[model samples]
Target: MINKKNILLAAVIFPAVMAFGQQYGGMWIPTELNEKEMKAMGMKISAKQIFDPAKPSIKDAVVQFDGGCTAEIISPKGLLLTNHHCGYDNIQSHSTVENDLLANGFWAKNMGEELPNPGVTVDFVLDIKDVTGQILGNTKNLDAKQAEQVIKNNIDVVSKSFKTEPHQKVIIRPMYYGNKYYAYIIETFKDIRMVGAPPSSIGKFGSDTDNWVFPRHTGDFMMFRIYADKNNKPAEYSKDNVPYKPKHFLPVSIKDKKEGDFTFVFGFPGRTTEYLPSIAVEKIRTEIDPAMIDVRDVALKTLDEKMRADQATKIKYASKYASVANYWKKWKGEVEGLTKSDAVGKKQHYEQSLIAKNPEVKTTLDEFNRLYTEQSPYALSRAYYSEVIRNAETLSLANNFYNFANAAESGKMDAKTLENFKNRLTEIYKNYDPELDAKVTAKVLALYANRVQPQFLPSGFEQYKDVNRNLQTIEELSKNSVITGRGTLNGATMYSGIDKVFEDQNSLVQNLKNDPLMKLFTSMRESYLTKTDGKYAEYQKQIDVLQKKYMAQQMETDKNRTFYPDANSTLRVTYGEVKGSNPKDALYYGYQTHLSGVMEKYVPGDYEFDVPKKLIDLYNKKDYGIYKNSTGDVPVNFTATNHTTGGNSGSPALDANGNLIGLNFDRQWEGTMSDINFDPRFSRNIMVDTKYILFIVDKYADAKWLLNEMKIVK
Candidate 1:
């Protein structure tokens, strides 16, 4: 029996109370904004001013930078701003041992000197239309796969119907776990060039030690420019390409930010599971994350030791090492945060309330609990596969070669596929160290064999269950397998030999089948596909269905409460205020950090905390150059309550008047868990203040011409 009156009362009152209590957690869609809430929170601009499709609005200024991060146009000439880490790969690609731009820094005095980057792109959202009605019509009786097909087919049809210009594309992404959908018309620019970046001492100041921690003074911003054809249309890289004239661009603000100043971030957020059930959270905290964390810990420890021993190895593996360590550290923080917050208990309590309000949904809640329990083992097995087999660089490469050999043996390899595969191998081996990967592979395999259940463990791993034996076995396999490229003549030519081996498909296949490493990978992959992957898929599909139902029910029962769709790598807006964090009883962090703090952390010749000589000289001369705050210190970075995630890197942090005040790069340490559960008390997005960016460009880099191109407001 369900009481409609009580349900209605809870819907209205609970939402209002929650909205009042939780001020800054949700990543809201621009279309379904809560204007009243925005106004109450010191928003000086209207909703239309933030996102208007008919005319240029704040949304037009933000674009997806290099696919994985966000950037904002700062000048009509398409001068783009993003996090230095976001542009790190492009900068590294252009660097060499002789002239390492990442080490010494690079500044383009003029537009002609800007370095062109191949394959870097930016996507601007032209429009976003809700197509749920069109996509979900006539789908009541279809199975999940059939319904999925219908949605995909409909999206294709709808995408084609949109009148888009050349180089423009349409993307339809499902939100709220397929409960709702929106089609985005996007314009992608292919000709992107790097303009300026500070030395690692400044850009990556306090590197790993200060990363994800507050009281930070990192200048983590990078500058680039988007170029278009003569007709101002998107085009591939060409010498003739000119700076793109954007519809709108953000004006940099140098005004000092006080505590509690209104702030908002607009960008493409990657993912968030804030709506997941308690059982799933418990599974992640108890089983999945720990296994992944342990595997990465072993891999990182091995890499770190090798990297410290040799400069060449350090340069080669720096980016890969950082990528692994970043998430490795974050996962640990997430588990700790979840446990400390008692997230499972809170979710269970919330669910109980939901059950009480709607007794009819009690069956659904039980099913959720049961399905999660049943799926935990398979999920853990899959996590092991992801962490060990799939992530080990050499094993992954060997698997790639195995696939290529199969394709050739089956007569399915064409010139295009073969050429693509060869090019991929070239890139893979460029920075790859076979010895390092071999060491990592041994540890990963041993971990999997020891931790995973006997029946769930990948086949053939049982033979090498002993850790020392596993290491010896992999070392021996590394010597035998031509794929590893160890002890091979002209190691440069070794990867190229992949093409020669492909000439004799049957022989290559037989060789790979006999290779110990390949054989091991095959056994593990077979066990995964047969015993783990299939069950995981079935359980995942069922879970997704129930989750969607749960989401729909929540929306229906709480119309008065604003139910924001979970982030699915779509453009979203999250607003809050300039704030600090009190992670512990006595550890309170200030919102703003300054150049003085950078000097305090500086150590001569230190990789992470070194200060540039020119910056030191400027500080000694007290050349604040109009960029310093009233306290006469140049502001380096700050923190805010704006909800952000991985993809939100390089997002523009706007003030109440919609001026670009900071560049969102990282989040506070405790706030890393905000991706799963945003607690305003601790969650704060770290940003590089705009004033610091301008100061570095003008005074430090002496790129006054670059500064002149922007609309800088005091």
Candidate 2:
């Protein structure tokens, strides 16, 4: 499907890496580490020191925080350190206008004052074992569908093989395009409590404007404690619980780090696609990312306007806005970075080289290219559907109502089901602003109709033809939507005791189905399911087969070139150096930002740039203590070449001796594309320096009690 000339041309343009060189990329598995390469890169600790179930190792200290981010134990008493943003939701839940912990700061002077969070959890890796043989040993001759079922069954058996503790969990995850599998035995601690956080002025300094950028001065660290039963076993929240005694905890290092200092990050990296084919990369950069970015840009602009105008709205939409803006800016930067780096060309170059050496790989590459070209439209449409429909609060809520109505019509509605759905709805409406949601719904649906292919457009789009007309229709629909207490759903009495809805399921079902908004949402959702469901699934299956073959072929062609599996929300290690970056022809970015930069960016009454008075006074007096660097400056944040991603938010940036020096929080905007295509030159992971963290704890917060608990090394 793709031409040889194009691949060759890209190869000619791409700057290929040397045949055998250490790439500061790849999220390597802990057990399968390249000890020789690590030593060459200045590792002072043995591989076993990084991960050994029988011994106290770094892996014992790192945890998957709330399943989305990473956190590390820095004290034997289970004092947890993570990115401030990682603990943002918990901070938000505890914030009120009067006691705005987010605006101010929170610190627990003692263990008894630590605030308990109900659903927040932390999981530690007990052990990770290779289970590829058991998962795939018997499925050599089966079709993809059959093989999937067999693999799942095998995973279940492998998971059950380990008799785990009460709160422990076992997950078997596929690696290297399902060519390998790793079974992880993990223990989840339910009693996680918030201990301290700097005000957003410090924690979220520069905010959205500086999110994925470098030269950052944000504090960006939070403190929490894991509580367990008296025996140090996992337990639910209780006054009787004690601080967890961990097997290993990182010691804080105040040693000065220079540009070439070796650094490695240990954490659960969320996802990466360093092995993506050129065609797939092209589609993502050119089509899917743009569509999603455009929709979010609109949503963010609308939200920003409202948030800036009202403080209440700012508090209500702060987290939501950040979540949306994060990936929106990321996608924008990804597209730019990919183009700038000629990532697609590089991928093509790699593929071309591989195919030249192994002609047998041609079939897989051909199928991959063909499927990619054919599936481009579907992928774009799917992204739009997600951005415009699935993400829009009103439409998403409407879909829930549609589901509940369908259950009623099908005679499957029960009191319990009704109550469950009601609770879910109430949660949705809790932070929801009807006016803002209405505006977003109108704008996004208009974008959907204008951009997506007409044939694949939602069935409801037939009612309105133009953007202006669609907006009017949406306005009317929102005003009359029964879900918002109008028309069929106008009676508040009906919802007061939602269980009563089960009494007349037939009537309720008919009323809900007849509602104008429900009718529109049902039409759109039903059309999507009918038209795209099986079709996309089939395409995905074929793509998977081709991708797996391609991945295997890549390995076979390069026996000497070590291949590490792409990240799949699993524990991994990526090492590099504390270094600066040359982003463009003339511009260069230094490795670190200092406390002086924080003062320079400060703005009075500014939400993002405001600095606390106490911090200012300390900075003014040069009261940094022993934490100050040799240059007589307090370093706040630094950049490294360590390969990292979303879940590495709170990962510990360790030194050559495996001592914690910094906390990984972000990647450079230009390097965000490292997820798909990592070029070490521009890929720098940002971290909050440990010295600055300690300086804040001691000088600003006067948190000597917390500081005394940590093993600080000067």
Which one wins on TM-score?
A: 1
TM-score between candidate 2 and the true structure: 0.92
Looking at model 2, which ten-residue stretch has the lowest summed lDDT?
15-24
**TM per candidate:** 0.92, 0.92
- Pairs that collide, model 2: none
Off by over 4 Å in 1: 1-24, 96-98, 238-240, 308-315, 458-460, 487-507
Candidate 1 has an lDDT of: 0.85
Clash tally for model 2: 0
Q: After best superposition, candidate 2 residue 38: deviation in angstroms?
A: 1.8
- Checking candidate 1 for backbone clashes, the offending pairs are none
Query: Model 1 reaches what TM-score against the true structure?
Result: 0.92
Off by over 4 Å in 2: 1-24, 96-98, 304-316, 408-420, 458-465, 484-509
Q: 618-685 in candidate 2: lDDT tens per residue?
A: 88998889888988999999998898999999999999999999999999998899999887777889
